[model samples]
Target: MPVAAKADVVVVGGGPGGFAAALQAARMGASVVLVEKFDMPGGVHTSGLQGAANEGVGGIHTELMARFEAAGYIYIATEETLPEWTGNPLSHYEKMKKPGDRFSRSSFNPEGAGSIMSAMLAEAGVEAMFGTAFLDVALNEYGDGIDAIIVANASGIQAIQGRIFIDGTGTSELVARAGAPFVRGGGPQPSGADWDGRHRPIPGGLLWTMSGVDFTKTAAHQKTAKDPTLAKLIAEADAAGDIPQGLYRPRMTGKGVYGEHYIGHPTLDMSPIEAPDSFILWQNVPYEWALHMDDDARDEARAKSALRGFIDAEAQFLRKYVPGFENAYLTNVGRYVGTRDGRHPLGEYIFSIDDAQQGRSFDDAVTSPMTKTFFWDGFKRHTFQVPYRCFLPKKIDNLLLTGASLSFSYETIFMVMRNFPWCTQTGEIAGFAAARSVEQGIGPKELQWDQPYF
Candidate 1:
């Protein structure tokens, strides 16, 4: 096979985690190569959500914020205006129409994000390969460590060797392909029901934007406890059989109308972007039901076809009842699903939501509450810190993993591992760990980050 450019660190997947891993390693003077299946970086942050890049968590994340700010691609809308019901009995999702305070986040122009990621990679001297897919891994003669990774791109199939590898792929593709052991999204569903594994999968979503929205008129339909415009609309739609039951549980984060199941309730669910238009909000548009993200069942072709059809049906509802969206149009549908959970890398450590809630740390912590904002669940306003062991494969010496596919179970991944901010910091940690391992002639499991590398 041909030889793809090798580096000290090879980060597969150019999403938020891969972006941070590659950028941090390269900035630290390591020859790094970042391979992405998509032509652009920013994974869900750019192409998927378009503006859900939450708060500036750390130096690197803050730097991304500065770039976005300079490009006029976003605005942080975490502060809340509907403070009267701060502690209402109702869940946060049902209390108001515009619910985003603890869930404070920013939005960005996808184009601007791509340009920024590209420019930053170049500035950091990182070799980034887009439209590249990671096939499988070649083990060493002893079958104890990874020798090289097989990849396919415009250059055809090739192999790339590295002292250390970082599996930033959101789906744990590298780790799985390497024959590593992992767990699927099976067990008791959040609804208090057991899943059969094959039939029941975790809930994944895709976010999109609506253009030509009349913000002025839509802005007026904000809901209060006494006058809930969003609830009213859902009721009318449900009565007309246009909306389905169990689609809008209001307080549940999974109940997003922009979801594959329902369209966002203008004022209740979404927020405005920083662009000339602010039609984009936190809505989903993928698998309304269970779909194993790691399985081929949730591949691109199937998700796209299903979501586009839902948008068509959603558009009719938007035009008739929703005030601001009366003239709104589907600007663009996301190319990839904002997958919440996937197979774990089964690292040396299994980071759990319980550990985060308890404010856990490790002797080799790559991220702590001090280095960056810890534990942001956007849904429950939860916060916690992550340890370095979460990224280390339990048995693989030369390989490491990061991002949502770290080690959390289906029930808890969304609360911690999957958040883009945390994933970004973890990527930075993975990169620095890979570089540190190379410099010390050691493996990532033996790497240390008890001190601040950034």
Candidate 2:
């Protein structure tokens, strides 16, 4: 027999969304238990091995930045000290600034992010269960809300109860397991359409880290318009059939952080079905692409083999394209395949591309910001407003979703909100709202968005 524990609120999946929810709810005086499949926190920020935390858009997300800075986890560079790319010095642009001084979007050291996030949750008195996966949800006879959760860990399966539940799983697995009604991909295309209507699988990008990269040397080569020795190396590798072609627009972080762009394909976006008992509010494009793949055993093996090839290609690119990477090596694979999006529960007001482009404002708004839609290549100022209704499912009570899975249209999701920062903000709001719901003994639907709680 497994031991049982209890809490006022339980959060599944310890990513950014789950972390924020657990911290916020615990601070609001709710006893919170945060379950995670990994041994640490920060989700993609740490495990995904993605470069840094983006803080251009602020709020609670900024709080995490402040924490990172205080812990000495950030890199500071200035225009005056900007490394020369070529004969001309590459201009140093301030992306994020601080009060009094200019704040720049400082990239974080992944090694530090996990520790910092864990510390924050500890400070908030959140009981964190690392390496634990939520197996099933137990509901009361009335089916009002989740009564307890069955989880699998090193020991085995254990049941834990809570008054309220928050599903921050990046994939919406919790809600899906709870029997929610969710939709994956847009419905069937018109008849006779060339679209096989099957979700196609694309190559997943490789995540790699390079050290000893002398940003100064590469920047100087770039400024002078000279053949960037680094680029030459990459070209050589590609010609030798080591890396894939079409690798362009490498994203550089200050001096050391860099990423390569690869292939992307359209597929069914993964979104959870809505249920009377639960709601899903986070979704993204990357998740959809992976979920749409054929689930046949042969297909699964092929996908893994393809992923290995992608990783090898990336390793070769680093060795041949950039200077200081001759000694570069693969650091770690992301805990989960790099997923982009998931199922967005149907909410009262689904955010559309028009609303995002128009910078729509709402009377019952929980949060608003001017930001780029996810994965849009063009330069434009697009801001969006999160309506209160979007947080509530039509039938579910005492539930709120945060993270990338919020209700959004395909156009808006593809164009905006794909960036990770947007998900952080939504997660913070959902966390605060969940705490309020528990305190008032009412469902999130009952709370008036216009009313001032603070």
Candidate 3:
């Protein structure tokens, strides 16, 4: 492919990180181009219907959330009254559907998110190349920086040149392509010689949604101190074959809240599918092991189909034994699978577990303290700061890494990464840094986080 266009900054993803990068760079007066392999912009947050941005956020996050709110996509969780999630589903978001103090969540329509991304980018003067996938990179003659990137689309292969490249690709395809060092995603280290007592590597899985659920009824089934009927229903289901014998226990609740493993199967989050309607919700099914995203495409597709079967069985257990889901039907499944781990480009500095929870101060910190990041180990938690150097690579002169693939040790990555708000905040950092790099004719290797990129 021949060089098709030149951009002051080219963002290689369309997720929150990529979207924020493109918009931020452009707002800073750089000619920015955002290329998304997918048609929509929200990526997993939108498509996976994450439905929960529970961590409190601010900055551009405030603006984007306002749009989702105005569009009636934001649903705040509350410790108080949550509406009857089932029945003639109430559009009014009040009352916790499940029992106990409910954490507020924001669930939006994926289709709506696509439009919001477009408007935000356009308003910021960013040019977007949708449905374009990044392939590989061609480094400059000295191999110190990228010359251009090759991409594929309907018109075939084309080259996109930019002064700086931001890898918000989630998988860190650029780093992998550039033959950079990264951690391999797999099971957490086992105990003993293989065991590290502190590091429990939880497996990752895919997210899928179901529609036409009597979420009110489903919520009722999630027996809390306030309610017991849902617990009773699960007890009955477990006695019967519907809930699976030894391995399956029908907490019959949202998976995120409880990482319960029942019968013979591994732990799974039966989170009440978070959606606009009460009757519709998705279960983020955990896998037997963490998925390898770099696996062959055909193999990956087959694996997804297999995972869907397990999820379908889980759904069937609820429908057959649970009270609220008698007529519940499968409306949709996630287009992207959730990976707990991925490529972690070695950066100038990587935040550690202690840094994430207690909050470490970095002289070059681009994120505010209000931008909360945490790692979860059952009941325990550690919060930390996301430093600018996490995205700044040690080798790539003109490249910045964003999204879930930023440099972090296996022990602390998932706790620190994940979620839309945090990633977008980092995206803004990468964006401003890219613009500054171009303006000063400096590479990311020479950029300093202590100085203002603006």
**TM-score, every prediction:** 0.82, 0.75, 0.80
Q: Per-residue lDDT for 225-278 in model 3, tens only? A: 334334455556666655543233233222321233211232223443245333
Taking the candidates one at a time, how many backbone clashes does each contain? 13, 54, 36
Candidate 1 per-residue lDDT, tens place, 1-454, comes to 8887888888899888889989988988889988888878888877675566556877678899788888877765433622322222222232443343354445677867888988899899988998888888998877668888999999899998887888888888888887777876543443322323443444566666777776445445644224344667767777898854334444324322222223223323444555434445344432335556565664645655665555565666777777767777777667677666577667777776566556665666554454222323334434455667778776667888877668665545654456777678778878778877888888877765576443
lDDT of each: 0.66, 0.57, 0.64
lDDT for model 2 = 0.57
For model 2, give the 10-residue run with minimal summed lDDT. Answer: 267-276
Off by over 4 Å in 2: 1-3, 56-59, 77-105, 142-144, 185-206, 216-235, 238-241, 244-305, 320-323, 368-379, 451-454
Deviation (Å) of 150 in candidate 3:
1.3
User: Model 1, which residues run further than 4 Å from truth?
Assistant: 76-105, 195-199, 219-268, 281-288, 298-301, 369-385, 452-454
Model 2 lDDT at residue 446? 79
lDDT head-to-head 2 vs 3, winner: 3
Residue-wise C-alpha lDDT for candidate 2, range 355-408, written one tens digit per residue: 866788788887644556333323456766668776665444655666655666
